[model samples]
Target: MKLRRRLGIEWTGVALAASLIVCGLIYWNSLSGFDNLLYDRLSEYDRPEAPDDVLIVAIDEDSLATFGQWPWSRSRHAALLNQLADAEPKAIAFDILLSEPGDSEEDMAMANAAAQTDNLLFPLHFVFPGTNGAAFDIKEPIASLKQAAAAIGHVNLLFDRDGVVRRTSLCFKDTANGTSNDEIVWPHLMEQVYRQINGESSAIFRRLGDCQQPLLMPYANRGDFAQVSYAAVANGEIPRAFLKDKTILVGATAQGLGDQHPVPLGDGGTMAGVEIMANLLNDITADRFVMPVSTTMQIALSLIPTWILLIGFWRWRPRTTIFVSVGLVIFILSASAILLSLQIWFAPGAALVGLALVYPVWGWRRLQATSDFMDGELKNYRTETPDIPVLQVPLGPVDLVTEQAEELAHAIKHVRDLRRFITDALTNLPDPMFITDLDGKVKFVNKLAQSGVEDGVQDLALDDMLERFVAPEGLEDVKDYLAIDQELREHDYVDFTSVKDEIFAMRRARILSDEGELRGHIHYLADITEVANAAQEREEVLQLLSHDMRSPQAAILALLDGQDATDENKRIESHARRTLALADNFVGLARIKSSEFSGEEILLSDLVIEANDSLWPLAKQRGIKSTVEDYTEGAFIIGEPSSLYRSFANLIDNAIKYSPDDSDIEIVLRSIDLDKQAFVSVTITDQGNGIAEDMLDQLFERFASNDDDSHGTVKGTGLGLNFVSAVMARHGGSIRAENVREGGARFTVLLPLAPEPEELV
Candidate 1:
């Protein structure tokens, strides 16, 4: 929720900033004043060089003083044309309007002179919203003069909203008297003159889409064009050689003529109409018009810097954003100036406004969102863990954000205290304890664990940590035990001798997060040196009893066997063998108890047959034949080979011992399912006196044997059945003894079946 709010604020800022720029572009005319101001300033430095071949013949104050009043007659203009013709100027543009018919002789005289002049041009003018309902009216010189001139063109200037002449139209298009079906187009007066001199349309005029659009014109410095008095040129006071091959413009520059207009020269002044025309002609010949960017491009560019700062708000600090905002302003202006130099105008006002508007507004929104989020979180924190006392903030009138910050600091300090408490408790644990993360790198160690490791043990791999503490012989055992999945391991703890020869039982448990994510593991090592040593000593004593007692008993059986026909000798031999069997049973029990159970796959049918065959001699002596019944086709079980062999031998031998002479003993191997688990069962039944009802319960118990009432010859050792029971339990199996209804005792053992090799893999 908090993240959403912050993103919401950020996107809102983006929309607001983008909307401002787009709207500014949409209503650009109302916002173009500053753009024009900037253009005027930027363009001054990139003014074009004045055209050297073009000269202005100004009818200025000095020219008026010499030529009399402003309405100079056509006869006078005729003389001027005749004199310029004598000079053989390359092209002459008569900028002064001569639309109306004047005195016939005077006009005819001027027309005749213009007809003689080579490449002579006359001016045409337009009156917009013309007489009647026409869109515009075109004014041209009388027919005689127009027929005489090489070409006649319109003299029109394009004014911006500020009434400054910054642009020029290369041509004008209108329907005749706004009533004719066909449209007529008039080229600019300078364009006509340039065509006469160069024999082709100017590149600037050619690039226009419809010859009606106005293009931004770059100006040369004021008064940069060479000028001469019209009276001197007409009176032949100037050298004719100086005028040769020059394109000349003849117009009024006198202050009294009312031909002056405002222009963008970075000065609060106006330029003469003739000089403005000279600048326009220079631009066409040089092809130096400034092209404006399209509207789509304008809005796209305007949004760039604003979005840059808007996205930066998420990652940059307020101070850095402020500096970037200023940089964006400079960047916008610099871009405009650079584009201006390339003869392209990209006004920077809309972009500057976007950058300026978005910075502070976004700053406010971001701060507000953050403050609200923090306030909500702090309130919830205080409410949820009320027992954790929050420290009081500074006792003064403080802003909400500052107060929230103070509360957050207090909460952080309280968490740190709780962490310290947990650390202390773990440090003082009685047993060696350590923690490791998912990567098996140790992260924490109790004091007892640290004592066994070097300083700076944290962050060491679990294997490296074990190397420092565990004995070399026990390292692989511990590693293999740890490698098993914790939940699936057979035993919860494994014992290993440390480097100091102290036995420790290591146990591990998972560390889970509150969300039940498995974060790491905690290992505890409990010292069991004394317990392990006592068990070892017991096993050694059992080893002494088994070996030392069995040797003399076997010697007695060997001596008795040589004299076996006598009653006393047979009795001695029976006693000696019983003692040997007792010793073996006791030792086997001790070994199985002390050692770990390591198992291999053994075929149950084959092992049962082998056990029966080994006891066949005894069965033959008693005239008891044991028949093997194989119900199981072939079955295997995982168990210790020695123990399982001994266990099966004990059960079969007991069956043969109790059976009557020549009575058959049955050994059956079969597969059965107990509960839902698969197992192989071995049953040994003897044809003899059945177990007494009271002795059946204690048949497999240690020292609890059933007396052989039917045979009454030899007493059985009770240790065998107990040892068999122990081995069955170790192999995840069970043994049961019961009397069959018809006769003798029946012993049954069930062991879990081993999986196939493919299943194991």
Candidate 2:
């Protein structure tokens, strides 16, 4: 589904880009304004060097001042041409048209002077909307001037749509379907001069397929061409040697004469008509005209980069695409400039338009697509998860992305609410708790957890936090337990007293992500101070009872033994022994339940021997033959000595009570392997009635006994087995009882072997 959505967005962008490229190619002329403007600006960097041979004889304000303007007589033009002809110039072109008859004497003088010159060219201009509805009416030099020594050519200028003269036609064909004599083709006046000088057409004219084809002319700098004042040349004030071997174009340059037109000089100024011809003649002579690219090439150049950027959108990020877009703009312009320097013109407007247009359009479309996808996903989430109601406001109408933004905002609000609820629950927890990351840096602490922390606890190291609150005596033990891998630690909780004398049971659990990856830990510090204090008081009371009550029981037994061997005395002695055993069991059970496990290295064989010896007197009275087989060969385990001694002693005493007279009670100690870890197992078996089948599951439970059908006169106190079970648990060990199949019940106890002192170090 995501793949399809992504493809859809890509296709939309491609289609938009293709449309822009097509429009650029189809309506290229409509967009040429920018290209022309750019061309005008770029042309300034490499303007053509004006040739020394082409010179303009300007009828400037000075000339008009001297020669008396306001339709200066034709005799003045005739005199100027005669002077130019005397200079031995290559050619002379008269820019002032003389189609209509002028004053008789001046006209005759101009005609006679033109007849004398060998290389004179006459101007022939056209007037639009001919009298007979022909395309245009040609105005030529008068009949006598035309029949003189040289050819006639048109002096019309070609302009672009924006009224700037940038191109010229070398020749114009007569296509009005007139008579053969009228169907003549005329070259530009500058072209005629070039032909007269070289005896051949200019290079641009020779290459034209048709006389009407326009040539893009590179202009010389304004006023750069050599010029002489008309009055100065006409009166021989300027030296003829300066005009020697030059093509002279004579025309008006004065502002009052109104002979100037706008050119692509980029200064928004005008050039005189004679100066325009001078530049054109220079372009023709040097063959330096700029040819525009073919239509197909222009379209290709414009579309290629636009499409490259369009494709780039799919691969690059928004930032990269933006840079690429700007780069494409620079590339297109640079290419245009380079080509222009090589005398080739390429229009960059359409290409630039495509690049500039497609970028933001595609960005908007992509953002809209992404917003839509997010909206759908968020809606799906709202439907699947438990509904969290949010108030809705009417927005009336909006864009899709804006609406999606609102939806996203609402979703974020709901998430914040849920987080706040969780935070409040944790803050109000009865017990203190803190959260830490995998690096053991505390990330969160509840109110209760902040009790002893002087400053903010966030991001504090776990060990540092523990050191701040945990009492000095238990800090090392807590740290050791926490240092062990959570999965490898045998115990679930560690007990520690805070600096404030409050006891706490700290349990750590993993905080996992939804995929069950461990992200951190949550340490819950349960306040067990009151429970611990009560347990301490109970143990003290039990200890006092054991010592105080055992003294009286022993005195009673001792008195009875000295006085008589009567039934009453024997019964009193039996009861007193049972009472003493009961008190010992109560005290041992209380101590095991309340106290923390602090172990030291002890030999398992020695403990077993000591337990057996402690109960030897009772076993001897019952005539039970107690035997110990030491197969373990001195295995050491870490355990509390007092608890372990009472546990083993109680096991042997139970065996003695259950066994018949003269039966053998065997205690075997052996080292064994359980789950790849070293352990010591103690098996005690008695030759007596086996345990009842119904009592096996609850054998280790408190107050559990098999005394319903007694095997001996002295019955068992149910708590003796319970206390032994508690002690075994504290030592990271286990005990189980089962029928031995031989006839009596067997008790197997397994305790993990402690590492050697050297190994621990």
- Which of the numbered candidates is closest to the native, going by highest lDDT? 1
Q: For candidate 1, which ten residues in a row score worst on lDDT?
A: 708-717
Tell me the deviation in Å of residue 609 in model 1: 4.4
Score each candidate by Cα lDDT.
0.85, 0.84
Model 1's C-alpha root-mean-square deviation from the true structure amounts to: 8.7
Highest TM-score model number? 1
Instruction: After superposing candidate 2 on the true structure, give the runs of residues whose Cα lies further than 4 Å from its correct spot.
Output: 1-34, 37-84, 87-277, 280-358, 361-369, 372-406, 423-529, 546-551, 554-565, 671-679, 706-717, 753-761
Show the colliding residue pairs in model 2.
none
Q: Among all windows of ten consecutive residues in candidate 2, which has the lowest summed lDDT?
A: 708-717
TM-score of each: 0.62, 0.55
